[model samples]
Target: MRTFLSVIFLAAFSLFSFAQQPYAPAAALPAKNLAMFGRGLYPGNDTTYHLLKRSGFNTILLSSFYIHADGDLYSGDSHQPIIHQGKWVGDAGYVKRVKDLKTKSSISRIEILLEGRWYGQPPNTFDFIRDWYDPAKAVPGIVTGTGKESTLYNIIKVLKEVLGADAICIDDESVYHSPSIIAMGKIAADLNMHMTLCPFKRNNYWTEILEASDNNLVDALYLQCYDGGVRNEIKDWVQGLKPAQPIYPIFMVRGSFSTCDTHKGSKSVAEISKQLRGFKKDYPGMSGAAIWQMEDLNSFVKLGCAIKQPSSGTAKSVAEFLSQLKKALKKEL
Candidate 1:
């Protein structure tokens, strides 16, 4: 009886020690070739999906995920839950469309974007991560050591399993807790998913997380070069992070946020091309670039921007924009 009790104690102690171990860093993956954010992909029609499949973008980032106080996951301002109480509660049609896009298109990667901000509104998604993530309870795969698991962990797993997401794009504009992010990164790495940082500012905050993750879990940095990050320079960010991963500059196209042109950060096609040329010149090793979103591309077309249309002129605006972007990145223009 004493021998049996001793064996059980040893097993429990081993489990405890294993749970307390820090996450092992893995090698980073290559940066995306050409990426676009699908901010308006949900509730989209066949036409939009068709455009995306032929858009020449190799990566698609589904944007703007929010986590409620009740641990329900929402996309953008949609009332429907993508994950309710750590289960897949999202639309079946939406998942099918995403899968179909990947199957038919040049899209090699799909990343779920988690954005948090302080617009003087209620608590955001990262805030929930900060509140719920306890380091002592965090373990690989099962984040909460307890069998119940954490809402964040469940959400990550569901995204990977259901939507076939390859990475989690961190767009934490307000909440900057390192422990929570690092813990989240560990969980992501364990699940065979990479983490990408979308930072407009806060270099130090990002640097800390990168250092803690051993600069491997984070494969790329999508630097916002528009809006609040208008003043951001690639050289400055490169010098700051000293990153092993590639840094892609994200540009906001014309007609963002319902504006026809010349929004705070929105740039015309010509302007974007010029900027990309300059960025490539500054960082000779620049692998690729990304567009801010798809909604803006549609907006530019609807707002009657003078885009050179094909013979049909049907869906030519989006195609034209993408063509120009690809040319800008490829050629030395």
Candidate 2:
């Protein structure tokens, strides 16, 4: 068994080495797009956060919490249950981290994904909200079967007053929360915040969020391109909208086999660099790509499961690639 495992490792390494060769760029490269690198946060230290900033990532999608296996909602540090089954889970760490990033570095954006429901499977929309807002029971306007509560408003209030985040990415895993969506927009507007709701790829939802505000509530229409490599479809989706606001494609880094997914796709660090090179070569509509997580990126390397072994060679290759990509964008665009 040991010998077989060794052979498997050797074969994987050989494949990675061979895949590192340079490739000819396609005849035409699209206009360069700006991209971002980010990750999820858990309770504890901010080692990964510092690592990403050092690695040249300017934006982060910092998650507040999720419903754990124990069915208890856990928030990062600051301990505010950012979300319960389908209700508000408020925590102070969420605001603190954002403020720290702003004060500490030149971090450009912090996309606050309210009530994200990524479990063993993508959580149901209702499950995205906490159970306290359940409609079959009490809570009138507070929930309204939308699973929304005024408490979420308070959380946003704290974010604006305290952290001063640039944008809020509301993952409306649930689609029917018009009142909640509208109310959330109003709060954002009062604070002069840029708001976006990543609906389940529904155009109407984006339109509703856009129209609901006194001014344009929605500044961006984010598509959660989680499954399959769908870059080609993204252009059409962006242009297909009636009014056509800016469309930001937030690719999943750890969820799919596409270049966006961090695990299992590229074989080595050099290969990962090449993947970024290819993005510059294609996809014009792409504003930028965010690493779904720095946690996944580091974990894959730590466990020896990353496509390419994490060594100085791999890390340097990735850094050089990102540096060149950014430089290329500045030079060419």
Candidate 3:
């Protein structure tokens, strides 16, 4: 009987120890502040560093790599895509800059959005039509159809070698099926990285992508709702996401160009704060939100809206409004 009691005690102790194991935060929860800063296509510059520091940004999302013309993987106009001529881009010293900055800055995460689609497509900025699709420059076994042989697989392989980033955003032009998305997700996992899928549309394209997510491809759903001042529409879209899944709302001020438009008659930062406060109250599960840019502060003023700048009128006003919004959000939470 004593032996039996001893065995029971041991089992209880073992269970207690297992339960006490350190808790790793769930990947779905929005990371601190849910704040992601967008850098211009080319951001290896001083202005970018100043803007990121002044703003309360915690993540830097960059688009520095590109598959250049001439069938080279990493050779773009200015920066070479890391995996050029079958070589790693990071090894070539591009991502090294990002890592160096990351070590020095308080930003906890860095993401490289890999733009996909063969040369000659609508958004193919590489002039891929002239270079990658040329029949003569093609490498027989590897270059395949378009001669842009750096398939999603090859491009990612090089990126992993270089950036060693915490996350990768798959900016595929036209994603339809789950297998393709899941395939991409598996590739990310193989590299010990998390994936964020950007499916840009107001249509039902995301419905199909959501169906395909069976623990394979994505850690977060990055939806770009560029319409500003439409609080109800934005609320509806947020509600449409799966109740349990995490969603990051991308609020645009430029590039996608939502900030240049009228703010539905609100002429000041105070009015904008009122709308944001209402939205935060309506949506409790919102992990966090991100602005499309740090530039374009002028566009808001032209539309008769104002922001708090650091010094003087613009910075001070905008900061107070943001602080108030933050306080209101905390109360709601």
Candidate 4:
């Protein structure tokens, strides 16, 4: 339970104000999105998005959503536009450029993950402490509970009109005692915003979360199987989670130059394939795979020890990994 994602770095980006194109929240895609960090939305470069659409990844997970004291749901991160050198910019033209690619690839599933803790219960409120560390981290979520209940309604109202986002990821690390989540689930369902969750350790928490949300509201679950010293084995985790909803394992991709890597996975292409084979053999069903933070993709693509061929890590590695993953997912469990 003692693991979290890394923050986003300031990447060079350009902005394109396209009169804020229409934001249409499409039907939720199957749970296989790539989890990313700041400038958010690959905030890395235009190539990031282009490569992803090429890499066969279906969804993009921009991290961190916080609840402001003002009841405004701010994105702790995500593909939020910012000012650099006194100029308004957006993912260095990544968002603007990738906008056209969405319909072409399954990568159309764009979501933001919300995390951190909250205090109190009465006002039905929580704290957005992640913003305290850095104000630039405040990305927006639909505001609720305050004087205005339509905050979510409003975001949905203009989703396609402004950011063109399609879904929300509940990364509520706070575990605050409140009805907000269950309530939010209802809102997501009504708005047709595909909702996802990242729950770790507590099975009861999973139970409670599912209990709170409406049936089918949580379209997918991305389980973190690395960093934390838990029984992260997919065979072990799926027993409880799969029954609730479709679950995808998001493994931590190892860096290329690292020697002292200390997590359960970091399995080479063949090793990962073997693991998927084992999962398939056991479950006889289930599918999809995801990785944390697309920034380390070069490292992620660099295959680990169990390589059987040269050029172990390449864009090919991603394509191969995803192909095997999709195969396993296609199996009927």
Candidate 5:
């Protein structure tokens, strides 16, 4: 009888220890890569995917997934929804292209960005999550039936099962509910998917989430260093978050919002390269950086940024832009 009691105690203790393990940062990407975003990627064809495959980017981030009240998912301004009533209703060809982009090219990580609006956008993704999540019915590391019924769980599950996404980037700009995000993180972990934070500010909010998860749930911090986040400093974030994971600064390149000039947080290639050098100097531990989007890059290539037209066609011009950007990422400053 004593032996049986001893066995039970030991098993309980073992489980406790496993649950209390501290967060160890996940391994950094082997090489610096760009995160392609915007409407350009959604409608990409063989030619587009082909260019991206050889574009030298190892990671692609599909931006701004919004969740409706009925548990449907939409990317940006597209009329068609990606997920409707917990089922995938998006284009199959888009999925095929993504799969091919991952399997056939250098891309290894595909992350879907979940964004909330600043204002006026009713029923935002984060807002829905905050409103729907009930702590009383929540379980640690398990998605209950109630959870499955919720739009949050279904949306995340679809991202994992259907899209096979490696991670979900939390771009919760408007909503700042800690519990909702923490709950989502748990669901993400339960589904074998990692979560990353995209923060322009609110270090305390992010820090709380990291601490609550013991830093295990969130693997990286994609710091937005463009537009509203232009004033964000790497050193400040590093000091504030004390994150075990690497932080990648996202830069808004030229032609953002279809403008050629460097206004509104858009920077020229040379300007970006120089800014990167400065950031590297400030945070020597910086491991990676990301371009704001493919839309801006495409716009810049298609229509010159206050200069002469691109010397080559779209594909070639885009390739050259990527090559230059990659070099900027790799070259020693």
Candidate 6:
């Protein structure tokens, strides 16, 4: 009889425990805040940083910090304000541009895109920045956690102290494993740097990522609503993650003049607003929308979000763009 009672008691306890778990969110949520991504440099656009400062996006996820083969992270060269040494330098003047932006406006945060090396780019071209996270190399210490002594941990420090990064965006397309994803979040949290994940799928990997991280360390997930994830429904994606986790549906700014990628799926400004609102209706806590390349955004996403920006095609300078955007936004407000 005691054994029978014990079984019943255990089963009851299990049921109670499951019932106590937090509820998954439902309902479309408002966009948390608008955001954008950009490479730190452009050929002739010296005022790129200044223009971005006035663009009114809450955060800017800079394109990227390369994870090395072993476990180290590349934080530019030894210089205090990292400047690329190589000639065809992709992220050249990263430190300086970020510094410039902070000086200009009060955008919420500036972050780094921790991405794997591109498939087409030759390994030699990336050696200067050590950009090589792949299925083979994997993310060395992200899951298990990295301590102060760890190179990856120090890289976080370098980002905070040197570049003044307010957060770190985990764009780990290489390894979607939960352990590493969780570890990366924990490490970034320990350093006082906010962690945001930009995931491509709505699957078990993300579910586990939130559950293992306890959905605490990660501030948001920049869901790629466009590009390969175009078919991804924001409502379902939001439900897949914990209710507390903010989601920002990021769209790709495509076309010939577009700087993000060659993938072209041009939606009108009205369509973008409708899709974003649909997500908000289903999940109210959504942070907002984000565009992949700020430079390529033109006026579609900006206008949809009510962020008045420069003319898509014009000979205007960055200063002129900022001036006009400010005036436009002031009138709208």
Find the candidate with the highest lDDT and give its number: 1
Whole-model lDDT per candidate: 0.77, 0.48, 0.48, 0.50, 0.75, 0.55
lDDT (Cα, tens digit) per residue for candidate 3, span 95-166: 546556555555666666655554425434223422333345554444422222434455556566566565
TM-score for each of the candidates: 0.83, 0.60, 0.61, 0.64, 0.85, 0.65
Better model by lDDT, 1 or 6?
1
lDDT comparison, 3 vs 4, better candidate: 4
Best-to-worst order by TM-score is 5, 1, 6, 4, 3, 2
In model 5, which residue pairs have backbone atoms overlapping below 3 Å? none
lDDT for model 1 comes to 0.77
**Superposed Cα RMSD, model 5:** 4.6
Clashing pairs in 1: none
Residues 110-201, candidate 2, lDDT per residue (tens digit)? 65656455443555433434443334545433433322244444455555555565556676554455655665666666555666556546
Residues 1-333 of candidate 6: C-alpha lDDT, one tens digit per residue = 999999999999999999777432221122446666765343215456666777665577776456444334543222122322211123446556776775656466777777655443534212312222122343434322255654455566777766677677866554455665565666676766667778877467777767766444566788877756888887887666654677777765432143322345434333455566677678765556776665544433333322232223222343443344333322322
lDDT of 5: 0.75
Model 4 has how many clashing residue pairs? 13
Better of 2 and 5 by TM-score: 5
Model 5 poorest ten-residue lDDT run: 307-316
TM-score winner, 5 or 6: 5
lDDT of 3 at 273: 42
lDDT of 4: 0.50
Q: Which candidate, 1 or 4, would have the higher lDDT against the true structure?
A: 1
Per-residue lDDT tens digits for candidate 5, residues 55-113, read: 77778887767776665788774656888766888888888887787766777778888
Q: Where in model 5 is the C-alpha error above 4 Å?
A: 1-34, 118-120, 135-146, 306-316
